[model samples]
Target: MLSWVDGRPAELLSVRDRGLAYGDGLFETVAVRGGRPALLERHLARLAEGCARLGLPYDATVLRDELLAFSRQLGEGVAKLILTRGDGLRGYAPPQPAVVRRLLLGGARPAYPAEHAEQGVRLFPCATRLAEQPLLAGLKHLNRLEQVLARSEWQDDEHAEGLMQDASGRVIEGVFSNLFLLKGGVLLTPDLSRCGVAGVMRAELLAQADALGVPCEVRDIDLAELLSADEVFLCNSLYGVWPVRRLQGRDWPVGPLTRKLQAIARDLLDC
Candidate 1:
């Protein structure tokens, strides 16, 4: 494993970095194989977009070169890229000519259990509700307290992930991944315009579904709809796709459509 901070090789994060002090940054977790960052283009695009949204400077080409060089050191693993606003003044006010800090941490190979992927995973509804913040939604920002709190609600190792809802009790997504449900032959995923990170894998799946002529919807989802879903799944760039076997005592089949998605994901990730 290897790590670099602020364009220099380092092992420990500075306590004064704005990312640690104020969560003032953005990050992307990418799967690196054979020294290549998977979906590098998409990740860079998202990083640039996040920086623009936060009024930060981001040169994608430079960052790309840095990431390539960093990943080459790891051989194969997960590459976590973080861009922070740097050490700031004592308050929330923005600093003039902010010093941006870039960090690349390595070593996170896919280690999900085979049984969970083959038979599917079990989930439970988390009492935590994601806050509605359109400005921050869809960006993989540093403010992830909601996910941390929701994930902490469960201690059972058998439960792979927990489902979170919006403030209005509308089903949103899993703690660290996107949620998809198949109900009555329709593919439904939460509209992340209001909240939740717009996962790269989820976007790819949606595009695939569109090309394959599968009926798909992006809108508000209710818990009752999820409870009645014929099948459910969670996805992120790292884990690929995982079928949900159970959710709060509700059982689901690893149906044909879910398998089709899995096949596409495998091809995309070269797994």
Candidate 2:
């Protein structure tokens, strides 16, 4: 993997970097298409929001220019942007004048089976439950231990993803993506006000549904409601949209609404 540190090419990352020291950083995984980063604006916006929430200094224009230049050289693949509070002396307290280190890495594109998209994916209900922290919720920060544990629950290749619930036993979202269910001809997604990452594709789908005159709601989703839903799907920037063929022992159809949303996402991503 090729990498750039603080605007210069580097072979190895410093062990002292606060990102490694305290997970004190934010990272973004972007898909490169035709030498351009997909959803560049939305990705940058989320990055900036994360930095602001952490009280870190950032220059969006510089970051954008660097990412674009780096991505162009990659041709087509995944581009990862990592920004961390620079090295600091021993202590839990953050450095007053925090120095920022930015790293960009490029690598091979991810491969997803074409059959999964055509037929649909299977999901397992995870035992791990996300903690409620409104202040830290909805931001893609570096602290992702919850996701790490949730994803480790299953080893079956047939199951494509796992569904996570909140501490109150409310169906929240997937480990790395957002969840949406259709019931009685209405679409529903969990509200991210308390927990879960508010994915960019989820926002786009909501907008498309509004324009298409499809009824949609963002609210707390219970496990019972999810189990009784007519259809369910998962979505993320990288995977586009995936219809869930089965969850636990229950089966779901790849309904018309799912196909309509998938077409919209495919057009937006040009994939």
Candidate 3:
């Protein structure tokens, strides 16, 4: 596994980096196949949006080139790009004329269980709730303690992913993925206006659904609503899509819609 700091091979990060000090950074986890990054445009789009929201100085063109080169070097695996506000002094105020730091790490592609996609996965109902923070709601920022804790809640193999919710008890998403549900032949996803990461795979599905003339909605979803759904699935850039079949004693069949979207996602991930 190779790591790059500021676009060069290195393993050390500045101790004064604000990403370590105050979680002032953003990141993207991209899948690479055949020496090419998968869904690169969507990943870059999200990174650009995150940079704009965080006021972090970034050049997408330069980063894109670096990403391509890095993926080429990696050949096939996952590339994690961490963009930080760079080094700072001994206080909370950001340094004047901040220099952004780009950290990229390469790792082996995850080997998720075949049944996770073929049959389905069970969701652990996480007790950890996401706090409402409209400012950082949709950005995949460095602050991920909530997800870290939620993921830590479950330690068994039976649950493949944990379901998270907002403080208001509204269904938010999975700890590591976005959630989707089909109700009355309509596709619905939780709105990220208040919390949760707006994942690239989630965005791709929304667009794909629209192109296929499937009605879609992004709005607040409660546990009751989610439990009543006709079909459910989880998605992320890494593993494509997994049909969610069990959660909190309830079970769902791996339906036709889940399979359809799964195929679309497989194509997108080139898996």
Best by lDDT: 3
Global Cα lDDT for candidate 2: 0.87
- Superposed Cα deviation of residue 228, candidate 2 (Å): 1.6
Task: Provide the lDDT at 37 for model 2.
Answer: 84
Candidate 2 lDDT over residue span 1-271, tens digit each: 8689887888688788888888898888888877888888888888888899888898999999998998888878888899999888777788989999898998888798986767889988899999999987888877889999999999989888899999999999988889999999889999988888988789889989989998999999998899899989988887789999998788989999998998888776653
C-alpha lDDT values of all predictions: 0.88, 0.87, 0.94
Instruction: Mark the regions of model 3 whose C-alpha exceeds 4 Å error after superposition.
Output: none
Which prediction has the highest TM-score against the true structure? 3
Q: Write the per-residue lDDT of candidate 1 for residues 53-129, one digit (tens) a residue.
A: 99888888789999988877887889999999987778888788888889999986968898777889998789989
Q: Name the 10 consecutive residues with the lowest summed lDDT in model 2.
A: 262-271
Ranking by lDDT, best first?
Answer: 3, 1, 2
Report lDDT (Cα) of residue 73, candidate 1.
82
What would the TM-scores of all predictions be?
0.96, 0.95, 0.99
Question: Candidate 2: deviation at residue 154, Å?
Answer: 1.2
